[model samples]
Target: MGSTADNVTKGSCICGALRYEYTGDPAMTALCHCLSCRKIGAGSTTFTLAIPSPNFHFTSPSSSSSSSPGSTHKNFTVTHESGIRLKTHFCGECGTFVAKEGAGENEFPGLMIVNAGTVDGEGVFEKLAPPQAELWVKHRVGWEGERHGLMQCAGFPDGL
Candidate 1:
């Protein structure tokens, strides 16, 4: 699917303390139903858009510095069942997760998994990139059911 703004997509934290934008199309889009994602999202699933690292940029000024993208966000690193370490960036002010990046020898080394829900603009969530698959469906909630017709994987998608 294409982005809401031609080849650009914008997003921010719940409190608008952090803003970000990415150019070009997402590498992939999917719904993650893994237990860790569920707990981190505080929901049944999380819609994510994977964009190339070079294409993603933080537009908001850092809470502590004007030049760096490091300060003001909390980074939490979690080791997945596959032994892949993923670091998630959460807004320091609102505590809303914005994106995640894989660490050291991970499959998606140059891609950032952006939280689709954080995307800005009216109807952006509905109009932005559509999920191409559902991941970790084995951990999906019983009542949520499945998103029929989409590629569903019990664990990680094949071929990365």
Candidate 2:
């Protein structure tokens, strides 16, 4: 993807029940293995891309899903871990966790985390928001000795 400010990327939940688009590049992208991430149902950490809230928005509902004003397939689950509150949004129909927004001592207040797996595997997803770091590596399970090429942080990383 080009480095244009208006470049936009598309994403959808499994079964395409929920769709979203984020403009430009992400603020940060990282793989996380924190306890909180695991507690939320992920076996270990989550692959996330940080995008400015202002640049993210839901796209038109697909023809297969409801487009009526009364539609509500986009739902979420909320959980708190280590005093951090996070809301994981998913498609109620397919249960695909698509995005997460939260508050924590080290969380970025201005950006929201998008589960990179939900997005298209095009250049934008691979290059524009490819994980550049790993967080909470100390919480990684069996493969604790493995390493990701990105920045490594045993706990929270700076500028995250």
Candidate 3:
């Protein structure tokens, strides 16, 4: 398991079309039961690692701007699409969702927030703590209602 002190973790979608570079230390890493995340990830919960927006970068070698043979860092840019003011760059070929920007820009101020499950590594999940709180508890599945020790909230957290 990588420590919180580690810098520059890399990840990509299953098809390799979407790639990302995360530089900042993740702030909150948790499993979310919100309906939106569950539908998109196709899982019971969505694992997320919230990072600063400026710390995330795209790193597909084919997109490098310089035609020269030796430039190391590829030219990359954050993109916006799908009616979302926040920049959401995904794979052009495979349509794999990559990293997102502008989340909590005005509210939290400086954080990109990528899905930790998308991160590439072994035992990444082990390093994270079990979710401290559950949002949108009104929508939680019936079976989950009896789970022990889960903090439940009827809606998004007051400050969230």
Candidate 4:
């Protein structure tokens, strides 16, 4: 059994093409109602697990750097298929969406945001802390009711 405080957790995408070992505490986890999220997630809202950069880990060993003690693992790679440089990685054979990185690299400092749905098992969502806030609510399709007691926002927050 994995505890909520577990340092590591495994996740993959739909086709299992990608695999990831996420570490450290997630900065935030939220259900996004943006159009982009809905299109990618295929759901009314997209659940994301945001974490600091240092906590993000990739299982694939990159040719750029050899593995060593205390060194980071390169389990996945960011693809530029859509010309937007979406940092999505997955296993080659299974095509599973593992984890995403580099969301708040420049402004927020060390931060990597990932989708919570990528985590394996049914209880992963139960283990995660409730979302602190909602983003892109202006594009929300319909009322999703109350979640975690946090009111949904119409758009990006003033600061965030």
Cα lDDT, all candidates: 0.80, 0.68, 0.56, 0.57
Better of 3 and 4 by lDDT: 4
Of the candidates shown, which would achieve the greatest lDDT relative to the real structure?
1
Off by over 4 Å in 3: 1-6, 61-88, 103-109, 145-151
The TM-score of predicted model 2 comes to 0.75
Candidate 3 has what TM-score? 0.63
RMSD in Å for all candidates:
3.0, 4.6, 6.4, 6.1
Evaluated at residue 120, the lDDT of candidate 1 is 83
Candidate 1 colliding pairs: none
Question: Candidate 3 has which clashing residue pairs, if any?
Answer: 52-112, 53-112
> How much is 8 displaced in model 2, in angstroms?
0.5
For model 1, the local distance difference test gives: 0.80
**Considering summed lDDT, which 10 consecutive residues are worst modelled in model 4?**
76-85
* Model 4 stretches astray by more than 4 angstroms: 1-6, 15-17, 61-86, 90-95, 102-109, 146-148, 158-160
- Estimate, for each residue in 1-160, the C-alpha lDDT of model 2 and write its tens digit: 3223358777887688688888877888888887766755466778888889888877755423443444534544454444556756667667677777764545556677888777765454445546788887767777655565788887756654
**lDDT by residue (tens digit), candidate 1, 82-156:** 778888878877789998888676556788889988888877766776889999998888898999978999887
lDDT value for model 3: 0.56
Work out the TM-score per prediction: 0.87, 0.75, 0.63, 0.67
Q: Model 4: number of clashes?
A: 20
Clash counts per candidate, in order, are 0, 1, 2, 20
